[model samples]
Target: MNTTHRTIVSRRARPAKEPLSQEVIVKQAFLLLREEGISGLTMRKVAKTLDTGASSLYVYVKDLQELSSYVLDYALASVKLPDSDSEEWKNNLFAALISYQQVLYKDPGVAELALTTMPLGPHSLALSEYLLKQLAASGMQAASAAWGLDLLLMHVTSSAFEHVSWAKNEKRSFTLMKEAYLSADASQFPFIHSHKNELFSGDASNNERFLWGMEVILQGILKQDQ
Candidate 1:
């Protein structure tokens, strides 16, 4: 009967668990990159997003440069090269480049990060190796294939940065540019004004511009093969 007089107490609340490893932290950083862009990415911000102390991140990532490399590698790791057996190596290369561009454009911040950092991780190396192998298979010399891969990747990253920049600061009116061109003295700038339609085509889509560059590079490679 005396046991009825006592009441049980509730257990104390448990503290939140820390991330299992740097892998989870890096994953969260990428999530932040996707949502907020590069400008919004910072150690403090990523820590907050991941619900951890910023100092803890330093143990896994030395600095923004390292973190940036990790993020770029993580993003690019998902891009699978096209089939190597197709014999249309040029087309496959072009398609792989397109896939790469799509991934970069999807996360504009990663595209910007890519411009500053060279590929140093396993994922980046794998991508370069795949492309180089594809190019060599397509009749390109090793040196030529290496250089071409470099040039193509540079163009893609830079182009993506340019597009992101333009999108962020697109206040300049295409209409105003056209009007000024139309009102200019034809004899003074005839060619410039004559191509106004083509010039002021209101921004090219990343896919279209990427495909165009791919075609140009592929053609050049074909010429070299001859």
Candidate 2:
């Protein structure tokens, strides 16, 4: 009888796994989010990715909601904020908001988290501070600045979510919807039938439309101050 020979490798020779911490766990969660959107961001999957049990993750993150807030704030670190003393505060603010939208667009999971979780993480705080400072520079009162910040962030986050949802949907679905809009009865839906081209002029993912909306919101806020 012939027997196959096997060589056993020692585990000691293998590289050591990276030490687990809140930072490591959050990073792994973000990676999973990027790969599989919001559905992939689960404590079980994060622990699995880290080669640990779900119970071990609870030692660092209290629950999935906390993990989501951490991941969302971590992703917001990529947003580009302008220098404090920039002359074009309005332009810089718009640019910052645009950057914020782009950051959410990077990962749909983060966009979903932005809508659901109130992230108090360092990066999230930084974003809030930057927006408030810029709004103040624009002559907005404390109330307007606070409320406007909420509106601005909401618009950007919702826009990202809508764009991501559309991307996830079938193109045929959008085509059918567009066809329905185009085929609306002129007598019953005069505005929709007449302004069909104008209604469908721009894409949700387009920065021009996004910028226009930002401008409108800022103008409205400044107007309220006046």
- Top candidate, metric TM-score: 2
RMSD after Cα superposition, model 1: 4.8
List pairs with backbone clashes in candidate 2. Answer: none
Which lDDT tens digits does candidate 1 get at residues 131-172? 887788877677678778877888778877877766666537
TM value for model 1: 0.80
Clash totals, every prediction: 0, 0
lDDT of each: 0.76, 0.88
lDDT of 1: 0.76
TM-score of each: 0.80, 0.93
Give me the overall lDDT of model 2: 0.88
Q: In candidate 2, what are the lDDT values of residues 1-226, reduced to their tens digit? A: 7688988899998889899999999999999999998899999899998889999988888998898989988998999998876467787788788899888877887888888888858999998998888888887799999999999999999988887778776567888999999999999999999999988787654677888888899899999999
